[model samples]
Target: MPTHQIQIWFTCTVDDFSSSTLAQTFSTINENIQQVLNPLDAICHKPREDAICVSQLRNAKKVDEAILQERPDVKIFLPFRFLFWKPQDLFRPNTYNRFLAATGGDHVISLIDEISFRFPPSPPLSQIDDLPQELFCNGDNRPADCGPNCECVHQVDIPLNAIVEVVLVDEVQSPNLSHPFHLHGYSFNVVGIGRSPDQNVKKINLKHALDLDRRGLLHREFNLPPSKDTIAVPNNGYVIFRFRADNPGYWIFHCHFLFHIVIGMDLLFHVGTQHDLPPVPPNFPKCGHHLPPITFDSGYH
Candidate 1:
């Protein structure tokens, strides 16, 4: 007989389960099976009373204490920062700049430079004498379907069979939520996932990560990275993935959440020129606008 090793993982408040018949059943099962507790699995109300407390993960008291110890001058404004705390605050460019300044991070850029750097036009690929002219639609020059009003259609043109590395930094809109980003064309290798080493820093923003990367503090597991098509980026951390742009076509990479995609949390990867792609099938359906032009008659019918 094959012995089975069972483990029960609780993701919600166990107190809610304790008063029910299910709790009794679980209690009986606990005698034989192992029960694992992970505070990061769920959000708890009255964490101190709960068996799995999230205090260690998101303790505002600790953050305040750290801030007071590091920068005594900002002690007066701590209450103000907390009083008007908003989720969108985390995404502001100034928030990153402030964090970099506070942490003594060298890799700091101005708000305008950061915006331009992050959302720059697609770069031209290295010239190849044998290859034909490149063809693709990117942010700098979008297709007709992507009109002046279409702010969501961000695109990047990639050379055929080029090695690409993508580092996704979670802005931490919500500490509990993780965005599962999915790429349509290719499955990439997830090489690394980590945050700042400093225990005092509760959250790791993009600037912090870039600074660490610049200083060679971050490590990549190039030898044995797991290949995945979709990856759930950690909250307040970063995920590094790499893949080859072997497929030649327009592919979408976006957050798995339908609502997030609707609101423009997506981008396109245009790989290779149109000549690199295979011929379309005879009955391949057409896409984009195909409205018939209207002609006004001089005489009434």
Candidate 2:
């Protein structure tokens, strides 16, 4: 396979942040990319002429002009402070003249701090166009979206055996926070993490090569399969994982972060199998009924 050129483009100040956290995060991402995209040269932090690094938005015009100036190739990772601009002042419906004016609606990855909501508050256009069908609706069971008090489930009646691949991202989402995401009756393999944001190639993988490289920097050879109830994702960096579906039901894959699930992270994996569901219990509440837990963590509440 040809070496894929994925740029880990992020902007940070030399003044504020220390170099250590950056190093550790970068190392984690480097090892992760090396493991997953084997025989592929994953460039983490390459300073190319094409890459755009913006710090202050002098005005909306400058932001627009600069973004248009540097036609980014793929993932555009925006910094945190950038999103602080008021939506009313910028990116309005009438002018429709904000950052969206610059680029095509390609895959843009924003560096959002998961713990806080810094991005703009607006419903995605699709929802505004038309409300989607209610597959399953428990009185606000959607994690993260709904506060801790709500317990809701929107049943899609999705069959099993449909999903061919699943990637679990550690960090951003961990097992302990809200809903313990459980894939009923099937298991998946864990892929490695993405490119490191700090360190360059040789230095980062050298450490993993010392420990995880049983066959010389090949991590899959040293990967440990799952044998636990809840999978714990890393905190700082993200994880790339894979899984398959063989079971036949409306399976639930949610964040173990209880509040996270309650918000909107909980999703249904409908494996498409051609089989009838087993008989319901004697006192089943309803087809899509949700039995409220006696005591759930108040993280979302």
Which candidate gets the maximum TM-score versus the true structure? 1
205-272, model 2: which lDDT tens digit per residue? 32332332233222221123222224433332223233334455555555554434434445444445
Judge candidate 2 against the unseen true structure and give its global Cα lDDT, from 0 to 1. Answer: 0.31
lDDT of 2 at 229: 27
Using lDDT as the measure, which candidate wins?
1
- Write down the lDDT of every candidate, Cα atoms only: 0.48, 0.31
TM-score for all models, in order of appearance:
0.50, 0.33
Report the alpha-carbon TM-score of model 1 versus the true structure.
Answer: 0.50
lDDT of 1 by residue, 160-265 (tens): 8766767777664355777777999897765556555666777666566677777866545543344568876656666666677779886777778664454445
In candidate 2 the C-alpha lDDT for residue 55 amounts to 10
Q: In candidate 2, where is summed lDDT lowest over 10 consecutive residues?
A: 53-62
